[model samples]
Target chain A: MKLTRYNPSTLTDFDSWFRQPFVGFPSAAQVFSDSGSNRLAADIQEDKDNYFAQFEVPGVKKEDLKVELNNQILTISAEKKQTAGDTEQTYSLSRAISVPDGVQGDAISAKLENGILTVTLPKAEHRKPKTIEIA
Target chain B: MTTNCCNPSPTQQTAEPEAAVMKPRYFVDGTQEAYEVRVELPGVPKEGVSINLEENVLTLRAKRTPSALSDWKTLHRELKGLDFLLRLRLNTQVDEEKMTAALDHGILTLKLPVKEAAKPRRIEVQ
Candidate 1:
């Protein structure tokens, strides 16, 4: 069976419809698409409370990294500089993720511990349930 | 005719298993004292990391330990549960004896000291 690579930026229903011919599982497709955005491989997971995204960023010091959020869009960018054989080489990777409507962008917090950068965006409000009384 | 027998193409090394997703991105920064090698290995803990240098070749391998939380379903799992492997051919200037490595935050940083002969030397003339 062929595996389809997943791109997280896809939120439209038509995107899933187009992917119907390729991968049967969504999680497997997401794993296969790690090669799309340069050397940055990140995972987004959901639980009862919040959504967490952990990105792989090695050799990037804290000062060279930047995280910005605007209107539910989170952008992670980092600049990697190295001096190889007396010649300076630089490379930068940036990824912008579109958060769902329920996420609280203002309450988002990020921390860099051990080389992985973890960004947590809490769910703003839970869906309210409605009930109709039977007479 | 020039013979390029010293460098071996990465594909020639067949000891790696088929399951491995080889050739991870790496950065080599050369300084006056030593060369720093950085490899991104997310989700790997400190215990399973290994770095070995032998016969002019440097090999890096890390095995992923299954987390005890099997009851949870994996959604959008990317970096976890995948083993890491990369075999890099090193130059002769690398001082194998003094090499050091550490794993933090899923990134492995290795310091390879340059041999004395390979370092730049200043000569005085009368």
Candidate 2:
């Protein structure tokens, strides 16, 4: 379904016109809306011991990904693009996570492999190894 | 013609200053020769671009000239950067050598053919 009037001169637009393309959904103008980076489908797993955050970033490179931490808030951002004459397409995704105090931001570690980005935030030393006294 | 991350502009001097959003369309057809996947990436020039098969994955990345940022008098807004990344995981039965890509008027066409053993065959009646 074409949301706009048809332009016969551009064959490229005619080729992929959907039958019922929704306005909200990403179109040629909004392809980046559903892009791997900006619209992340992530899962955050947490336990009594630690918190695990896994972000989905398909078709992204390690060099293009960025991770930042400020005031106990962690942010992850990535950008990927394809440029042509008179057209530059860019896809970007960013997410900010709130972390409780006492967790060391300096010790955070992140790795990107096979399009999935995994971030590991270890618990503080004092938070572990509690001594149980016999009553 | 250099496009900056600070500005969302296309390099075409005559083209309007409005941001250009690219939509890469594809046509996929499976046949006896192979499964053909043709992606439409328009305005891509033909030079210093490579298509390679690594561990059954088809990756397409090209380094082209920077887009023209001079089209705008003052950089007000920026949306996308200057680059392209397209990657695909191929089927085991695909013939990588037979695959080819061509760029014309911003359309990128990729032809991937199938392997002989994977093609469907009719059984002879005894």
Candidate 3:
């Protein structure tokens, strides 16, 4: 199945549609205006087994990146000090993702290249069915 | 690109220092199958959002309905200003009819499915 892009501003059926409730009214300033250089983009890849998350977090040091796991949920957060862009201003961006059940937490790993941060979460073994004799 | 239909034009609102103003951020990504565009517009409710396609241009505009609820004693104003704009141009191969948008969690995602003629296909043996 293909997932369509979500545009909140252009939604015509918001009143008639039922959702899980928004995590506060997210605004452009809340996400983009924070202390430190912000995460410019994120790429989430999910297959039959596991999910991989990659983020473009430039000008951030390796130690600044933080990852937390709680009850099958994973939240990746980071903070970068202000650079040339806004020396007088500070900004931060945080994203939390819920991991599916039966996945190993310690096996997750992250790597930074240039300014991109990539995290790979391996899926737990999937169960397959087998037939048994009726005798 | 400014069409003066609304009471307070967003572009002008962003220029003023009355309240908190926002800046538009564009996300452009390419995968093996297609390219995705994610533009972030926060604070504005879904009712005030509009996306239009004319010629090769794709325009996005979202604003906030200035609220009347104000607490004089408890208010610490951080500039909750309105007016946001996101605009783009599509290539000739993009399928305009299949374009989709959803406002989830606060992120505006636009999924422009590629035309069948533009996708890569493999020929099988007869």
Q: Encode model 1's per-residue lDDT on A30-117: one tens digit a residue.
A: 5334465554555665455666777767666789889998655576888877555557778887665656667777889987755667
lDDT of candidate 2 over B1-126, digit per residue (tens): 121101111231245344443323444555455455545442245673567766666666554333222332211112232345455655545666677776643345666666677667899999
Ranking by lDDT: 1, 3, 2
Chain B superposition TM-score per model: 0.75, 0.63, 0.63
DockQ metric, candidate 2: 0.03
Q: For model 3, what is the C-alpha lDDT against the true structure?
A: 0.52
Off by over 4 Å in 2: A1-37, A47-49, A82-88, A129-131, B1-111, B114-126
C-alpha positional error of residue A131 in candidate 2 after TM-score superposition, expressed in Å: 5.3
Q: Interface RMSD in Å per candidate, to 1 decimal? A: 4.1, 18.5, 17.2
Score residue A58 of candidate 1 by CA lDDT.
61
Cα deviation of B78 in candidate 2 (Å)? 29
Give per-residue CA lDDT, model 3, range B73-119, as digits (tens). 21112233446665565553557788788764235667666678966
Question: When superposed on Cα atoms, how far off is each prediction in RMSD?
Answer: 8.0, 21.8, 20.6
Say which prediction, candidate 2 or candidate 3, comes out ahead on lDDT: 3
TM-score of chain A of each: 0.65, 0.61, 0.58
Please tell me how candidate 3 rates in CAPRI terms. Answer: incorrect
Model 3 spans with C-alpha error above 4 angstroms: A1-35, A38-135, B1-23, B66-80, B120-126
